[model samples]
Target chain A: AQSVSQHNHHVILSEAASLELGCNYSYGGTVNLFWYVQYPGQHLQLLLKYFSGDPLVKGIKGFEAEFIKSKFSFNLRKPSVQWSDTAEYFCAVNAYDYKLSFGAGTTVTVRA
Target chain B: DVKVTQSSRYLVKRTGEKVFLECVQDMDHENMFWYRQDPGLGLRLIYFSYDVKMKEKGDIPEGYSVSREKKERFSLILESASTNQTSMYLCASSSRTGPNSPLHFGNGTRLTVT
Candidate 1:
């Protein structure tokens, strides 16, 4: 079974601080990676996704993720985070299937 | 933009009662999914439908069933609601064209079983 692992369960930092969230998946075949964010009382939205080509994938709100296939990792990063970036982030992996397996999630609390 | 709509934002049901959660997508997406979200558990897939009247078991489909009679609508059914089933239910839809087509999520339905 394919499983995604998020290294941090919770993250806390101040506004403008650099942020990085580690994600690792157990799939050994062709895989797609994604990061989804859920704000308070809001629906889950796509943060970014990595399909093929460039390992560095960038998405809305200045969020970027690097797909390191050899490491089986797709780590999300931001040069600076704002208070609005505070939310629950989920790492998902789809491997040779239409369905995706998500990690346990990481709650990021950004202090204003 | 694709829009996924979940019928209810909140629902409360008693144990042993039948529960129905409806979801609809405006786009003609070929894939629809049902997921349950809990604190720290992220989202666990319960069921998914690729086409009309076609359903597939997800990672955790033990006590749930799904119906996709139409391309735009997908319903999740609980034969007998259990307390453990109390969680936020999220519906999502994605196109079948590319792997990069991200899933558009609904606002989610918070279901509480007593």
Candidate 2:
């Protein structure tokens, strides 16, 4: 079974602070990875996804994630965050079979 | 733009009542999924369909049944709603025939079983 792990449960940061959310999955074979975000009252939207090639992938809203195969990690990062970036982020992985497994999610609170 | 819509944004049902959650996608996607979102559990897949009339069980399929009679619509059913089953139900669709496609999601239906 494939499972995703997100280490950060909650994070609070001031505006313009750098942000990094850790994500790791337990799949040995080739798989697709995705980062999804949900604002307070909105639905989950795809921020970015990794299909094949290119370890580093850029996503919407100034977010990016790097897929490191060796460590089974695909960590999301942003140089600076805004108060509007406050949302719950989820890390998900899909195997060749198309079933997606998601992490527990990290709630980020950006202070002005 | 792809659009997936759930029938209801909020629903309240009593215990032992039958509940139906409808999901529709406009993109003619081949794959549709049903998931439940809980605070600490992330997103748990309840069921999925690869093609019309073909359904598969996901990680958490217990207490849930699905119907996909048409390509554009998928329905999730709770034979008998329970308080523990109260959670945010999410509907998603993907174009993948196998498994490696990005999914588009609906706004979700928040179900409360009292």
Q: Top DockQ: which candidate number?
A: 1
Residue-level lDDT of model 2, residues B48-111, one tens digit each, is 9999999999998999999999999999999999999999999999996556568899999999
Among incorrect, acceptable, medium and high, the docking class of model 2 is: medium
Candidate 1: where is the Cα deviation over 4 Å?
A: none
DockQ of each: 0.79, 0.78
RMSD of 2: 1.0
Model 2, span A32-55: residue lDDT tens: 899999999988999999988889
DockQ of 1: 0.79
State the displacement of the C-alpha of residue A75, model 2, in Å, after optimal TM-score superposition: 0.2
User: What is candidate 1's lDDT per residue for A1-112, written digit by digit as tens?
Assistant: 7899999999999999999999999978899899999999899999888888999999999999999989999999999999999999999988776798899999999999
Clashing pairs in 1: none
For all predicted structures, in order, the TM-scores are 0.98, 0.98
The number of the candidate with the highest lDDT is 2
